[model samples]
Target: MTHLRAGLVQQPAWPDKQKSLAASAEGIRALAADGARLVLLQELHATHYFCQTEDADLFDLAEPLDGPTTTCLAALAAELDIVIVGSIFERRAAGVYHNTAVVLDGKKGRVGHYRKMHIPDDPGFYEKFYFTPGDAAQQEGLGFTPVETSVGRLGILVCWDQWYPEAARLMALAGADILLYPTAIGWDPDEEGDENQRQLDAWTLIQRSHAVANGLPVMVANRTGHEAAPDQSSAGIRFWGGSFIAGPQGEFLEHAGEEPTTLITDISMARSEQIRRMWPYLRDRRVDAYGHLTRRYID
Candidate 1:
């Protein structure tokens, strides 16, 4: 496709799975009705940000690959004849879980998936305690591989993975047509106003840089509203919903605020090629000297 009409659903999630799923479905339907051939939803749209507190019983929230989240999204894709990208807390096996992104194609149904590689462990965000980092080397098609769908090859990455340029570069090298991030990020309510602004600005800048460097359009969908910590350990997170779509040159095609929004924008699929020809960052990469990147530190 030379041009693709994409939709991004940025909304708040609730603790109830059914409620959250219903909201996501509504946004998907609205976007599809707006003539969007592709729709993207925020991370863990089915439930609240449960990583705020890790409890053994919380494991019940994890579902199989063919669980309700994927099943529902697949059905929607079939119904609307539009490709949909959704996130899931995957229950891979006993005591093994991953933060995964699932792609549903209009014609092919469920096409591919990507497991979040970078797991963050912070005060308000304690993901390392819950998710097992994705091991790309252990499996054949598990790592930074793009999910091939009818619309295009989607390089789907979860929240923290968005920060790593290496992750984005690998996906681009593997032939990703576009980069998509389903994120659930927010600011600590206790943080100062200026600090929070800086955090949000940095987050936006890094993602746009990926688009500029890889010469691919970027789509980001983030949840909105404030989610209180289960254990009241902190003041909770006020999710800064700045979901956006950026062009190959890192130009903002569409942007949202800190509220529920459905971003609809038409991206020129051919622009990436034109931009790459102009910049040609990939053609000049020094791949041979980067072998030491595999090491943790030079010292």
Candidate 2:
């Protein structure tokens, strides 16, 4: 019965980079003290959720792959002797950026990273304007590949990618031991209460389904608090921080409230193998008949 203790940091971030990073560092330290071998932080923890509005100057917030955020997390992973997964706004080249999740092993520094494949351009979440969708051509087959770390093979994905089961399935098929999502999701402050609840419920339900289908544990870390738009064009988003961990059978291991929190739990890695034997979804898959999955539409 192999067990891995994992920690998730869900917190509010401010516009100030230094203050925001300090808050995240504090949570990482606390989790490490509690004996967590792996810690996952919310998306864009080093700064505010600036995607509320598309500003040309906001690109200034983008950083290189080995920039300050990765540097800071690598130091913490080394000092605490733990594996850390974090998200960053990556500046790949001039006028090209991506929403990337980075993984660091204890003393190994930056192990690998996954650029977000699904880019969303919704009312409040204007992500497509800033993030170029990750392409297999650009990464040279690294797209959707799980990162190998001391703790386990991390199937790391970003915020908007959480809604797609194909993304989760691809990671699972590629031999990911566990799935992790670093997210910045929330409700529109003006929406009716019932509608907001439905959205939140759907978000939780979809991710849990991934765990059950793949026979793996799923960890999600979301930011909390309300963030106003830079231009004040509309009512801002109230980030619902329901960070959680679900087991292989879609059972909740730990679930958090809307407030900022640090959640920790031990996941039974062997449970996945045991459950896969009982439910054998992989053995029953009809892969030969699903060739049209690559098509844009079946028309």
Candidate 3:
């Protein structure tokens, strides 16, 4: 039975970049000691969630592909001998930026990256102010393909992309054995208790559904803590860090609480194959009749 030990580092980003990187590196080292071959860090793990407000100066947070953040991750991956998926706010060019995930192979160093395609712009998540939507051409140009690592083919996606079934299906079709989401989502402090729970439940349910639908194991790493607004115009977000790994059947293999922690679990590639064979949802898909999906609406 082929198995892979995966690790998730769930923690809040600090105001200091070096401190946050140090924390993440420590978690990776611990997981490596426990035999985790692949580890994932949360979105923008090097710094605080800066998207809470839109400030022109915030663009400084974006770094180049070969910037300090990726440089540190690459060196850590090499030292720990673990495949690390680290998210970054990429400064693609002077004015162009993106929410990107860099995959560093332990032996190969910086291998490839996945530019986030879905850019969300809500009250709290003002991503549009900082990112340019990644298209197929840009992805191809940057080699944003499923990275083949020691564990399996990794279909790495950022936070907002997890909400789209189309993205999951595409990755599965492209031969990804597992799905990974590096996220930094939180609850609006203004919402009621029930509403907060509902939002969290929905987030978990949708991701689990992706696992079941695609017949692949799903891993998520989310930040945890309350990051206050700098200007205090509104209540800040409380990051709900329920980092978890779910099986191909949407069963929870391992789960974490709303605190800083490292979660390590072994997933069976053989089981994923068996489950997919038994379900056969992909074999029964009616692709010929789904051309309308490309249209904005059927009207």
Candidate 4:
């Protein structure tokens, strides 16, 4: 009968940081009213997806770990008596930045953060221009360890990290009860047919597989709406906001649409225990045989 109520806030980010923060706070309060103990916001919830283009000015968007964004979220968490997972453009130091997720504890204030490990450099996702890869050597110091909370130990990752099963496996092995991904991913408006559907399917399938493999619930919060390119050289990205939650057995617990929505669902820790006992993927892992994983290429 051990259960935890989780909430996912999937919404479009406004150009104005203050306005987006207000809207996000309102959404979090609403979820709290609905009995959610742990609420997660979409990646970079306070501002637009500045990574759409590689303007040097966008670097100004990054803030320190104890900056205004985290301060506001921590206060909100304390006020609402809930745990919040919020993503931010982190200004680690001068000329050093990272895509980070900050965990706010209702009673303890700002608890920890997880910097994004995998930085993507695709056509639309010019993340490499803006962010530095997280330092793996300081995993525990940088908040890679699951944040201990009243509901459960939360294993949080950012957008690009969702594709890598290795990251999920490491978190699960370290005693994470649930995996949470705060993502901001979308499709090119020009290619909105079979390709779009295929991409979305692949994204959904991969995350669900993580849940099944780790024997833990997985929750994803994605942004929605069309964000135009700053220079308007091409059609903007139409964020495919299909935020969802799946159980330990990869059963769909709740799903959202391509619009501003709030998804709330109850996760059963006992069910996770049952699934892990039955599946035993972790027990069967051949750790000693994974040395090749560290190599760039075997050939």
Candidate 5:
């Protein structure tokens, strides 16, 4: 019976890179102390939600894949002998950038990275301006590019990617044992009461649906806090951090609050196989008839 104890690190992020990274390290250490074999960090954990305002200055925050942050995480994961999943701001090149997830395998070094494919260009999130879409097809986007860590294959995805069923399906099909999402999303300050609740509900429902559809466990670690728009300073985003884990059949396992938190939960690897055998949805899929999925509309 292979089992894993996973930790979700949900914490507030400031506008300072140094402080935020240090805080994440400290939080990770604390979770490791609690006997977590793997820990997941929130999206863009290094700094505030800079996408609030599109500015050329923010590009300085981007760094090479082998730069300071990834370097430190490599050493940390190795030292702790635990798997670490981190979302980072990557400067792929001068003009090329991406919102990517870095999987630091303590046993194997820097294994790989996943570039965010679904870049949301909404009011608060201006990711499209900053990120070059992975450009890879859905098959390449979320097909369980595991880090081959100390424990097992770590299937990690970014925030916006969670909404697309194709992404999650590809991960499960690629033999991912667990699904991890490092996220940053919340209610708009201008939105009213019920609207905020509705948004949060939809976010939770969509991710859980992915878990249920794929018959695999899912974990989400989100940031919490209201970061002022750097330019306006008057209004900003209130990150409603409701991090959680869902089991096969979309069962709610454990949920974190709308605040800074670190939680660990045990998962049974066999359950994935057991559930899949019973449901058999993946086996019954009509892949040959899925061409219509590519179309924007039936018309």
Candidate 6:
């Protein structure tokens, strides 16, 4: 483990898959030019917030594991000698799809994939309709699994998955060296005061806590800008941008705000090792008594 340069692509996405792909490719290319060795794209980088509506035709967007999108990204990774982590919609079969993050290593290796486990079903976020609940490896089925890349073992979890401490801990226990999340979260464009601040604070605090609890570096790349639905007149979700990188102690290294940009940060794997040694939370575990965590409530 040593110091390395990593990147986050935080651009506002589009409804057209081709345009979104091109937009993000530009960011990745610029980051590579900046000498980034690992690039993390925001969740579902090649589409808008389609999870908002669950039309059946949206299924067309889902691709096979080794689809055209992966082909392009693979070529990009090999050309730049940089690892690329992209969130994709994987069409498993006729009607099954998973919210997956596929890792393309520098050598063009299809490193691995992790489906999003904690799917959220909120007002603006209706993921349950499109995503098959991840059969995370920590459990029993083929859910979210952290991916390994040339930089390190990446604990890739999606947006809603970041809220759960258990999610991050399980990945760490399973040998993940870094915690990564590709997100799409924001406020309603009409939010005026304290309520908006609270939401943003909670979002940042929770993710930073993941790093604090696990003693690992955390990267959260989010979408920027606002996209309006065709017929809806309500305040659309204003993706607050603010893509960030946090150290083991939950210190912010770099963060981008409500704008289209790519952020490059220095990831010190050595620093994380040192923090883990001092904290030693992983060493002082009560794994034997943690079975109750599996249940919703312990009576």
lDDT of 2 by residue, 1-299 (tens): 39999999999999998899999999999999999999999899999999999899999999999999999999999999999999899999999999988898999899999999999999889999999998764242268888989988899889888999999998999889999999999988888778999999999999999999999999999999999988998789999999999999899999999998899999998998999999998999999999999999999
Cα lDDT of candidate 1 equals: 0.92
Each candidate's TM vs. the true structure? 0.98, 0.98, 0.97, 0.97, 0.95, 0.95
Model 6 per-residue lDDT tens digits across residues 1-299 = 48879998999889888899898899999999998998999999888988776678888989998897888788889888899998889998887789988899987567888888888997777788999877745542244456667788889889999999988998888778889999989887777799999989999999999999999999999998887754484667889988999999999999887889999988898887799889999999988999889899978
Query: Compared with the true structure, what per-residue lDDT tens digits does model 5 show for residues 183-248?
Result: 999877877788899989999999999889999999999999888888894478888899998887
Give stretches of model 6 more than 4 Å off.
138-144
Cα-based RMSD of candidate 5 = 1.9
- Superposed model 5: Cα runs more than 4 Å off: 137-144
Task: Compose the digit string of candidate 4's lDDT tens values, residues 33-80.
Answer: 999999999999999998878999988888898898999999999999
Q: Which stretches of candidate 1 lie over 4 Å from their true place?
A: 138-141
Name the runs in model 2 displaced over 4 angstroms: 137-141
Question: lDDT of all the models against the reference?
Answer: 0.92, 0.92, 0.89, 0.90, 0.84, 0.86
Question: Could you tell me the lDDT of residue 93 within candidate 5?
Answer: 87
In order of listing, the candidates' clash counts read 0, 0, 0, 0, 0, 4
Lowest lDDT 10-mer window, candidate 5? 137-146
Put down candidate 1 lDDT per residue, 1-299, tens digits, no spaces. 89999999999999899999999999999999999999999999999999998788888999998899999999999999999999999999999999988888885788888888999998878898889988786243389988878888888888999999999999999899999999999988778778888999999999999999999999999999999999888888999999999999899999999999899999999999999999999999999989998999999
The TM-score between candidate 1 and the true structure equals 0.98
Give per-residue lDDT, candidate 1, residue 182.
Answer: 98
Q: Give stretches of model 4 more than 4 Å off.
A: 141-143
Better of 2 and 3 by lDDT: 2
Deviation in angstroms for 203 in model 4? 0.4
Report RMSD for candidate 2.
Answer: 1.3
